[model samples]
Target: MIKRIFAALLCAMAAACLSGCAEQTPPPEEHTGTRIALSMASRDQFLVTVETSVLEHAAKNQVDCTVWDAGNDYVVQMQHVKDAREQGYDALIVNEVSPSLTRGILREAEDMPVVFVNREPEMSALTVGKNAYVGSDDSEPGRFQAAWLNDYAEEKGLEHLNIVYLTGIEGQASTIARRESLMDHLKVDHDFVYDSTAQFDRAKAQVQVGMLIEAGRSFDAIVAQNDEMAIGAAMAMQAAGKELCPILGIDGTIAGCQGIRDGMLSFTVRQPGDEQGRAAVDAALALIAGESLDTVSGVTLGEDELSLMIPYEPVDAENVEEYIS
Candidate 1:
């Protein structure tokens, strides 16, 4: 009888122990969301458009994002990165103030995933696991510019060409790639009459091109690294009462689209800022979620698989309307 009673007591204790163990076991971890930091080089028109797109997509993807404008200053940009890290950002999207300063940025960013956008850094600085670049193939826009000019010349049965090239900020990846591609390809059959940096500024391009026109420098074509400068060059030409030649540009901005519609710009390559912005956000989220870039749509790893190049399209009278909408 005492043994039976002891057995009943042991069963009750075992049941109690099992219930206590069940209560003590932890549930699976719940994922709240991701926080992102976007540091911009400046609030320029193109970047502003990109910023808006990023915000739109971030909201759609349930990622919290904050943007800090670096005002084209390297020191300020570095500070922004540090702040983002201290604030516990899951990832960073930096439009570097200068491409050369990326080394410092990576050092300051430490463990955070960085998606460099618009202006790209050196390939050596990029790494597949932690850091990546997001931009149009820096070479494609310039190549398209040259290719379109070539086709136009061929179609019109034109022979000689005089070109004025307005460059972006010196040493920038985009500026270097675009200028090199255009000059190398165009020089095969054309003369570069005036080639200089307009610092990616409309007013600067206007002043420089105005001076070129005033000096009676004759050119049959003008190519600017970006649409803002291209539009500015066209404005300078209009101000001088000179007939507009084939004014080509890249970054098919809204202004550039209007320029094509208004017959001020001959053609522009659409760099798809919206797509780039969305890609950056998506890539950031994917990194936070520990997902592979290969599984992500609208993104591709570079040759070394360390960067992402968004596709670019040539926009002109033929296909400008689709982009405008």
Candidate 2:
């Protein structure tokens, strides 16, 4: 009996020692560099918000960072990604030019860490690179924007309502998703007529609107995918003596909100820029520690790279004074 009790005690002691050793193990080594590489499709109010948010977060965390503007060119952004990877950036963030180009980006990363923010990529998996991912859901913005537009249309009793959708860089993911989702809702539910997609660049959107006006076409509403295009469309509408149309935009930038206050913009939506910026840092940190982004799953941009779909709500003249300008 004495021998049996002694043996049991020895076994218990060994198990406790193992459990303590496991519990006391330190986390994995962090990445060696303080540098991060960031690229955006272009510099605009919306992109600026995302950039500023990321830069500000990096600054606060004492992380060294460099940002590049792709000038709205997929080729240029592609080269930038290749260069960033070669230079050994600790982590990379890209606001992709289009959904189609995203896989190419992943392939070029060479197993380095990468993440996409507001603009989601088209890859079908949660993991794109060895330690990276695209972003949050692409459909949430569509639903939110569609529901608001539908409600507003219903309230105003808008029939034969015409809206012009302005997009960013032709094939960009957010731009395409926003347009398709809104159009689908309009066609099947609201019976709205939103015709044509105008590139979201300020000059281009204005030019597109001008062509429509010159051709004797008219729109009852002008909807821009981002604030830059919305403001540009407004300028063109005023120039063409078409100011009677209601105008709406996304990316509730300071300027966009100001436009709403001035009665020039009927509404716009806000994205979670700060959260995305911080998320990129958090993801990189997790990767460096040999942990998976899956650890932050519930909060990781819908459990992928920081691809979280934040709700964008309508901001109009009614609430413009309180929130904008």
Q: For model 1, how many clashes?
A: 0
Please give, for residues 136-254, the per-residue lDDT of candidate 2 as tens digits.
44455566566667777788777556667777655666767777777666632332344555666778888877887888876677777777788888888889887547777876778
Tens digits of per-residue lDDT for model 1, 211-308 = 99899889888988899999999999999998999999888899999999999999999888988898888777777777766655787776676677
After superposition, which runs of candidate 2 have C-alpha atoms over 4 Å from their true positions?
1-33, 125-129, 133-136, 187-194, 294-306
User: What residue pairs clash in candidate 1, if any at all?
Assistant: none
Error of 2 at 8 (Å): 65
What TM-scores do the predictions have? Answer: 0.87, 0.77
Error of 2 at 296 (Å): 5.4
Q: Which segments of model 1 are wrong by more than 4 Å?
A: 1-33
C-alpha positional error of residue 242 in candidate 2 after TM-score superposition, expressed in Å: 3.5
Candidate 2 pairs with clashing backbones: 135-307, 136-307, 136-308, 167-200, 301-308
